[model samples]
Target: MKSCREATRLMSESQERRLQLREQASLKLHLAMCAPCRNFGKQLSILRGISKSYAEGGPERTED
Candidate 1:
């Protein structure tokens, strides 16, 4: 099993889909067994999602 720190570090530098799968799996495993790490992973995921939205323009789309 990978440590939370190690998993988080991998997540930080990971970009490709395959790398993300491994990082996310490690993160989830740690989070499932550790409350603190769960919070940490949740925050990181939320932050990443928010940042991605902002990078792509934080606006709602409407169908015409």
Candidate 2:
């Protein structure tokens, strides 16, 4: 089984490049059994989306 460190590394690297089939399978298996890692992955995706939106000038902020 892949360790949390390895799984997190894979998840992060996935953001920069495509993972191999074996890597994907291993990550999937690890995520399925690890709640914290799965949550971290979800949060990572959310942060990536937010970053991309800001980079793209997705919205303007207004002061309340």
Candidate 3:
């Protein structure tokens, strides 16, 4: 069995557009069986939602 950190790393490093269906299924399977990794995924999702909300409402900062 993979460590929680290893599974979480694979989940995070995976590309949304590039991920195969099997890869996604595997990640879900791992998360379902691993409490720590599941918690990590949940927190990551929450943080992503917050960041997206902030970016949509906050002033735009261009780096040009």
Q: Which candidate has the top score in lDDT?
A: 2
lDDT of model 2, residue 16: 97
Best by TM-score: 2
Candidate 3 lDDT over residue span 13-64, tens digit each: 7624456787677777887788888888878788877888898996668998
Query: Where is model 3 more than 4 Å wrong at Cα?
Result: 14-18, 58-64
Misplaced by over 4 Å in model 2 are 61-64
lDDT-best of 1 and 2: 2
Q: Report lDDT (Cα) of residue 42, candidate 2.
A: 95
Give the alpha carbon lDDT tens digit for every residue of 1-64 in model 1: 7886886666565533456676678766766787776676668789888999999998798999
Query: Distance (Å) between predicted and true CA of 50, model 3?
Result: 0.8
Assess each prediction's global lDDT (C-alpha) against the native: 0.72, 0.97, 0.76
